[model samples]
Target: MRQNDAVAANAGPRVIVFIVFDGVTLLDVAGAGEVFAEANRFGADYRIKIASVDGRDVTTSIGIPLGVTDIAASIESADTVLVAGSDNLPTRAIDPALVEAVKAVAGRTRRLGSICTGSFILAQAGLLSGRRATTHWRNVRAFARAFPDITVEPDSIFVRDGDVFTSAGISSGIDLALALVEQDHGTDLVRDVARWLVVYLRRAGGQSQFSSLIEADPPPQSALRAVTEAIAANPGADHSVRSLAARASLSTRQLTRLFRSELGTTPAGYVEMVRIDIARSALDAGRTVTDTAHLAGFGSTETLRRAFVEHLGVSPKAYRDRFRTAIGT
Candidate 1:
């Protein structure tokens, strides 16, 4: 039987604690909340608690308030601690008390995660000094400039550098949470959560930032947008560079230049990355390599395997086995 089948055959409850700071993005908190809350549906006993720096009601970026029952003390007692994103606080200027508190939690927690700008908190607490980390694409330049000592992969949706995990913007928090679910309870449990939430099952934590591939300034005309939509709608289509350019009504050279100028990559490269992203997602959801590649726009399994080897440094089967075997969900 498959690893997912084995995981589903045995599962249990887990504790999750989310920390919310002043002026935090509500969506970041909500995404984490939804994921942990959804764990109960998969036969996992889950208790999610929302907390604050001072155990007070915190105001969100959008001006909403939420009650936080526990302080950073929750982190010490929980199985996982997720730090939610904040709006405009200077990360390095994080409150000294909060910093020490987070550092204390990191020292003892089994799993630690940060969403969006909450990464600043992690960085401030020295949880991500030499660790691979990521945050909102919009904050990449500032984050890099702020913490030159940290290795920041701005393109990743999230980065799991050893024990510390960091994720990009709001919705991507769901992706991070789902990734954690896969890590603990297996992909099947995450898929069940995704289905319940009506979202994509698995967008790999390493997929590119939206602007990493296309348009720093949103494309003026809808033609490029249309082409992008088409590709997503039919990821299995044969989208050669020339053919794709034709669809967008641009000459091949113009298309190439536009992609480089706007998205920082060539058209062929973007297409392949997108295809690989699709394959990664399918694989995470337990699809076989041949099926995933076909669904991801590759012509054959060989093409998929080659790309996986070249870029991800692992065979599809190996990735599935290791990722699954780790959790024993």
Candidate 2:
């Protein structure tokens, strides 16, 4: 089957199925569910459902039970199928039957996704071979060790290569869901969904993990943490590599090296992302683009608008209209 254009706006009603396993991470399944459910809030057509390998009641890692009635056959009819991760215990393994089921469904579904340790399941089914994908960071080494052909970027919060998308741990699943929402419904709708969820506005899949920029190894007395706090506190400020290096008592070259090694981004790019994040927060809180631009440290509304379009592929007003609550309760 052919995959539709990746950036197409919301289409009509589609079925999303999450395959749950024993000792599954409940949040992985719920995170995807919430996004599609919230899409309905914008009058976008979609539905969320749960399925299991055997159409039985499945238990979560935390002991909660989910009564999933659909079976693998449901995957053939699904527009999208999500595979959720099991608890991060070493004992977990993808069932042979589930592997076959996923492979079978993979033949029919429009798209496939994995969350956290669920990437392990996709790898097991041979679906991730030669594809760029990611799992939870804690599992990255093991995943890479097991699947040598898959280009596992250990530092990413998620990876979208071809029709298969994989997200990192718990909260990152929410990020992945918001991205899917944006792809289907538009940026504005996803933003509103994020606001309704009381979370930080969505970060693009390309955005690095929040902790990625911190120094992995620092001298005990180094002021790196304080410097990072200051950067976050004043994201709108002109935070140059030299300035941060001075604040941390390290050479500019040393600071840049640290940022590259830990964050997969230069210090400047990280700061720009911080500013964008602040602007998104302001927009989510109902600020207009003009106000958000000023509050988030952009020198002008036009600059902010251009940046939003370039980085997010949407306008500031559209982002706010899609995400912020229209009726103030």
Candidate 3:
């Protein structure tokens, strides 16, 4: 057994405490907690707890009430601490008491992490001042402006800097937790836990948080909007600039201008993005590489491979191996 595995084998269950607060996003807490619980169910020794500032009942953003322990008391012996995100973080100021409590607990914990905007709290506590971290994509710019010292990766699902980890919004918290489980036990256990949870065993941190399908938001009546919708609906159709211009009833030059002005990409670029998105979905569904290439409008496996690498930083076969759910391998 590895050193960490041997330690886990001899020691009692490691305590994984989640720090929650008013207006917390329930999924951030629930998702990570479920991952650890599933790991425990798979014979890993982990004890999970929900903790808050006062150990009182707190209302989640969606109005669910959760009972939590007082972090000041409960966190002293924690092996790992995760701060759950809050919807109110961007508007409201960080609580001084909570910051102090997090700082105190983090000082003694073996591992520390945050989920989504919980990174805001970690930043306030000075834990992330010199580390790389990430949060929700919507808040990435503001988070960077607020914490200039920390390197914020807006696209990553999760980032680990030394002993500290931070995940992107919502569901990515589950990914981070599974990664921690893999670190403590092994890949085999993590795979079992992931299969139980029905999630990818690993979505590499580099995978984008935003899919190309939803990246551009054009006006409802804009030609760019119509063209984008058409591309989405029929990814395999000819989406050359001339073809798209004809569909939108504009000259090719006019269509190119509109694409840049409204969607911030050329028509061809947008078409490639849409094709990549379609290819990802097709691959996830266990489609053959050749079939996915044709269906996604790449027309050949080589073309699809290049686009997959350019957009997703992985090859078609590698992407399929990591994310395919249909085969149940």
The model with the greatest TM-score is 3
Best of the two (1, 3) by lDDT? 3
The Cα RMSD of model 2 versus the native structure comes to: 8.4
Give residue 58's lDDT in candidate 2 (0 to 100). Answer: 91
> Over the stretch 139-254, how does candidate 1's per-residue lDDT look in tens digits?
87678878888998877788897657999877889988888888887888888898999988865434342333322432767456666777777877867778889998999887
Flag clash pairs in model 2.
Answer: 10-184, 188-322, 191-323, 192-323
**Which regions of candidate 2 are displaced past 4 Å?**
1-11, 88-91, 204-329
Q: CA lDDT of 63 in candidate 3?
A: 95
Give RMSD to native, each candidate: 11.5, 8.4, 6.4
Q: Estimate each model's TM-score.
A: 0.61, 0.61, 0.68
> Where is model 1 more than 4 Å wrong at Cα?
1-13, 90-92, 204-209, 212-329
Better of 2 and 3 by TM-score: 3
Candidate 3 lDDT: 0.84
Using lDDT as the measure, what is the rank order of every candidate, best first?
Answer: 3, 2, 1
User: Model 2, 212-272: lDDT tens per residue?
Assistant: 3232433455455666567678777778888899887889988888767655577776776
